[model samples]
Target: MGKREHCRTSVLFFPTFVNRFGCGKAQCTGVPSFRIGHAGFLDRLVWPDLNRRLSVAKETIVNRSNRAGQIAELRKVVMWLYDKGRYHDALPGAVQLVDWSRDSHGSSYPELADSINILAMTYHALGQYDAAEPLHVEALELRRRCNGERSCAVAMSMNNLAALHFDCGKFGKSEELYLRSLEIDRNAQTLHNLGVLYHAMGRFAEAKPLFHEALEIRHEAPGENSSSFALTLNCLAALYFRMSDYAQAESLWRRALKIRGRVSGRRHPDYARTLNNLGAVYYILGELARAERFFMRALRIRRQVFGDIHGECAQTLDNLGSVSRAKGRFKKAL
Candidate 1:
């Protein structure tokens, strides 16, 4: 019953939100135009009115589509606000939709399930683990009742709940749930997550085969440069590094870095982690020059992305300092 803490910064910028006018200006301009910002003015006037209408619609609405549309629009707005790091503003609207979906249409089980999932995720994001847990449990129960436990939808619910367990440090419970979910994935991504769980638990022997299996599946079913694939490669690289297989580790780290860069930008934390891992491989290989370069690059990127006091940046700095000291650059190390 643990909710994920809401520490994630908003991925969306309020200034870049697309207006209802459907101009798609945000997508086209790469920056929101004045017209989009002006739309906030409309919210001031319409939001109160919409809330009144939405409340009435939920109770006595004869029109299904209109009620659905109103709730959907509110959900979208809540999601947008959440993405913008405006959790306080987003929560009430999200809760409103949860109530609406639960009560408005008696036959809309699927919609209700989806809304519950969203509510659960939102609560998780806010660190309300106690609140999030029951919501996820409810959704899982509904999915299982509607579509057998082996169904992909149920697998997703189990995986999500397992992740929540992992985040909450319930490793034994997480392992049990993950194993159940793994039986249902029949796909590389799920296996990859299982591999990561194994790696986290220091079960390198178990993790390695799973990573290789995921890689093979991805090789056969290639498409977009998926973060999941990159993560699999990175986990394998880390496991290899732990085993002192520097050559294989370095190769996988570079490949993971390339995929992460292509998909999530070079400045992303995933790339920083890859860079750090690659540097560790070089450090062990006694290739001090290459190690220093990668470590420094990683340090800089982590600092820029997460700031100097962040744990990731601190780790990178410590690594760079250790490497410098080993190379007899004591002054530089300091």
Candidate 2:
């Protein structure tokens, strides 16, 4: 077999092994039955320990008689892993989901579209944007085919594609999609995403009202203390900080931080993000000591969640270094 075909075969059979062996804790103890000719491909494509466990236990999950139930359980596991930030581990399962859906019903099936969406999301999370965009495009087309042009499903797909474009720095395309999505449904998430895009483009005046509208929608729908509401508040705080309104920014950030803390705890990435932003505000205000404390706390939490070399951890390090320099601790800053 060609390299691509061999790799595909490996992924396909790995799940069969899992299904037959059972996925429970005790069921994963045996040796994996399937083997890939290109070991490097497996190493590069899958998380080692997770792939082994899944390969052993995926088969015993449900009988061959209950295909739908098996797919549902697999989807749940894939989403759970994705939620836990195990993006690499989630990718294989997402691929299996798409394959199963397509094989059972056709490429144009609704379940195929859903699986494609999950696979795209997993790729996006893993920073494989090139791989993600085409899948997202396919998913959008499938959703439109199945649900009509102006349906909520189509609008959601637009928003997701917009997010991908925004992340890729295609601001024009992102804005166009966001506008289209807004026309279909006045959703809070779409509004907040547009606000974020505007903020990134330095269009603070245009961003502020969008953020406000999003916050209002969230407050009305899910209440003020919801994580989504806190996210909008954080975005507004960032805009205020950019405008040099330090006092206003600090107040907004603190409120958002409190809400995030209550909802997701201080260890959550959102809470750490707020802490970092608050530290920057304090640093700008010449409260070096207080800024250092916040930066340190943010660094600790980011290290716990994302480890030492991630963007967030690096940003906190930069801020801490600046504070040290301001305090005349040249050696420490270095």
Off by over 4 Å in 1: 1-67, 70-108, 115-135, 222-224, 286-334
Cα displacement (angstroms), candidate 2, residue 119, comes to 2.6
Top candidate by lDDT: 2
Give the alpha carbon lDDT tens digit for every residue of 232-253 in model 2: 7877877777787889989998
lDDT score at residue 214, model 1, on the 0-100 scale: 67
Colliding pairs, model 2: 18-57, 18-58, 18-59, 19-58, 19-59, 19-60, 20-59, 20-60, 22-57
lDDT of each: 0.57, 0.64
Clashes of each: 7, 9
Candidate 1 lDDT by residue in tens digits, 4-72: 111111111000000110001100000011111111201112243645554554453445566777776
Candidate 1 clashing pairs, residues 3+ apart or interchain: 1-129, 2-129, 3-128, 3-129, 4-124, 5-127, 6-125
Question: What lDDT is reached at residue 79 by model 2?
Answer: 58
